[model samples]
Target: MIKFLVLCLIFLFLPFQAATRKQILIGEINHELKNLSALKIVVFKPTISEETEYASMVIQAFRNYFVKKLAFDLKDRENISIEVILITDKEGKGQIIEQKEDQGQGTVFFGKSKQEIKSSFFNKEGIQIYPTRSSSLKENLELPSLLEAQSDSVLFLLDFDNTIVLRDDQYRGQGEHLKPLEYKIKELLGISYPKILPEETSINIGDKAPNILLEGRKLSDYQGMILVLTFYPAAYSGIFDTSLITKRISEHHLSMMSCAMHITSFDGLSSKIGGLGVGYFAVSESTPEILANWKEVLETYHIQYINNPDYSLSKSFGSYNSNGYNKRVCVIIDKKGYDILPISIMINDYKLGKKKEIQEIVEKLMINI
Candidate 1:
């Protein structure tokens, strides 16, 4: 059976032959990665095959962009080791193929599986050698690219606990002044603050909320079905403070009523007082330490917002444009923890309407899913 032996040898050696003039990305192989302290990496020159130069450029760009992030993630997990075998121009010519996606452009190339390594490199698409965890890795891995940082506008991010403190505490110089400061609610109305928070940010409506504490009380424990997270200057007996407090509270009640016209206020603002009632989780005043903490978190998340004690998040996200915080606005976070949906942001109305109709659109997006 000399013929049989020849066929067997060909099959065994075929992979090496097929691998020539192409890139090889060895990922998720069961072999010990920890043993690999460091390994050499290779890159294959790209050429225009049956595909467009633009499409090839994008793919090549992404591959280079993501490698660093991928390596870091893998190292952090401490489970796998990856080594780039080589990158070379394609040796043989093949039929061209192109894949497109819904919003933006997406591309796929057809050739030897070994030529290109992708997130979906090894399913039914590639040889499944050892049962691997590539799919799981794909989910957790975020490829680093300049795509996210390129957005032109400045993004002001804030965290719940640290950036703004809702409780009363003695502060050092200049810290007290920072509190009770009013935000230019008017500036927010007409100005574009991204006008949208992406689902990727993970803050939403109705999501199982973490128990937020205020004044030594867990707001999460409130039995009331509706929770309102309102911000405002603390209640003080001064004539100016008293009038502002009363007027703000009255506006909150009125807005709740309007929301009821479309839906019942019961399941609507479920009587929960913690995340609900006036001044629940609202951070009215804060200590320097507390403010810094919130600032750090905001910077980490890239949330865009200007700090103003006079303007609650409600007023800023709601009607009050550039001028200051006034009128109470509510963000109905869904059970899944995303902004429920943005409603109309109207400047024409005196009470200040939703300027971007973000609430309605966000609602539709949540509902359809």
Candidate 2:
């Protein structure tokens, strides 16, 4: 009876003991491999879960985000790779398993429980483990430690919304949720850029204007001609009514010099002003959808449309917004290719239908030029 009771106790405690043993093995492996130069990202794939597809989507989204963010510069960093594991509740539930027999080399593990895996990847020296609730995962994820672990080439165990099991694509979330993590990774990799530039140092008047590619032609190709560059939000946002502005500006014969003048419009078909010296050109980001939508209007106006798809032109001119639109500002470039305006002149507001302000500004600038 005593032996039978002891055996029963061992059976009850066997799972716990195995779990503890796996935890120790993971710690030892992490300690042994923390200083290696190869960095691997381990994602656990659940063998039995109704949300398996959702988890796969999340993984793909993460992979896509990482590739889109880092692929351009990843060629220089050959030490990074992603590995997926088919993890089950029994054998590898919360343990670090090696990919090969070569110890201290290759992929690591992403434990099922947060407490089971104490990350040595982000710590300067030795592993630091913290107990955390799944809801407060982001707060307790030790982002600062991640930033500090810049020198260590180690694997990352990413948990999406506190669980490896996601319900659906919508529940998987978007890249915005992972943006903070992405930014930290980029910073650690030394490839992060500032979100916003200082106004004083950004593009300003009197500075040599940055060159722009309009369609196949470079802005430099239009040198010696006074360029009236209009940056607008979209084809027809009502903030800057292209039709009215074009008509107003064309009425003044701003392009009478045959110097290749450009005007952007939303509703009107491209048409040449009769015997007018003004050359009407419209510039926009070149995309198939935009081109298709604006085809009829562009044809009606007879306007030369230039493609600025990346918005590099608008951004260089300080007219771009982070929300993927250009500000309603008109930039006047002199014949010498310098931004001649001391201040951005406000055009018509569609709400008020005012047109005189832009007319006056353009007329005045033309006279001075």
Candidate 3:
């Protein structure tokens, strides 16, 4: 009878012990972050083993959330830094086993924030807890406005079973749960969310190049020469550097055509090119602010500009995106006015800083020209 009573006591005490251990682990994580003053974003993943596939999914979700929803270029680490921590359970103790940095690429569509960015973790009950802030403190004192809380950093706690999965029986990582977390982070950063428009069908290889009006002439007018159409958001948007691309084109002596999403002046024409013209898609009915941002680029590279107030030109080529800007792509049209090179090939080559492949394609097409 005494043994039976002791067994019941042990079972009741087990849950309490587990809860205590969890709280201890949470304390340790918070202490670790407090010691690291430089880390702006910290992600904590707790696991029973070394495997971190679910943790990776969480990171990818954050990347997609920020890039797709907020338009934040995660690659701009100059303004933000992230650290991912892996906490492993060994013999009932939580230990931080690994740490690494991530770039999180995408551009900031809204204005940049000077506030320190942070992440929050969900508790066992799925309630988000900001580790740096005290829970007992008054709400106003604990949760200050984003601009007022410049020094505070957020931490994220991810558990494979509880935080990542929707059901205990399911294993897939659903990103829908991350929306609230993303909005909280955005609010903390003091940045407004911008509406993203839908993307249109893009131009494909072998399709006849759209005969859109370019200045006074049509796209077919350049049928005798191979045309390279490079589409970008705008000049110096930090999304893509058109100046570097133009320099590469000039060095390779490839005939080039550039497109933007705003009004631009095209007075400079380079004599070195087989053909050169800049086309722009208007963002609004009224003339948007003209920076003449590319005028220097034009004079320096001898590139010409053409204005197309119509967004159809961008849509026809599959360069239009929801951000009222052109998707970064380089489409190659053969001298016969048929798209000979896919945008993927050109974009991939440019990203790798290898213009040789594109130059080779242009040379081969020039043979037929």
Model 2 residue 46 CA deviation in Å: 44
lDDT (CA) for every model shown? 0.27, 0.35, 0.36
Cα lDDT for residue 154, model 1?
Answer: 12
Tens-place lDDT digits, model 1, residues 1-369: 999999999999989764432211233333443244432221222222322212222222222212221212233424322232222123224233333221111222232232332222111211111312344432332211212211111111111111211111211111111112212111211221212222222223323444544344443444322333433222110111122334644576333222112112112222222222222133333222232322231121211112333333433344233322222333433222233322212222212223124335334434543
Q: How far off is residue 112 in model 3, in Å?
A: 30
Residue 322 error for model 2, in Å? 1.3
- Strongest candidate by TM-score: 3
Task: Compare candidates 2 and 3 on TM-score and give the better one.
Answer: 3
What C-alpha lDDT, on a 0 to 100 scale, does residue 60 get in candidate 3?
Answer: 31
Q: Is candidate 1 or candidate 2 better by lDDT?
A: 2
Clashes of each: 69, 10, 15
Which 10 successive residues of model 3 have the least lDDT summed? 116-125
Task: Give residue 336's error in model 2 in angstroms.
Answer: 6.9
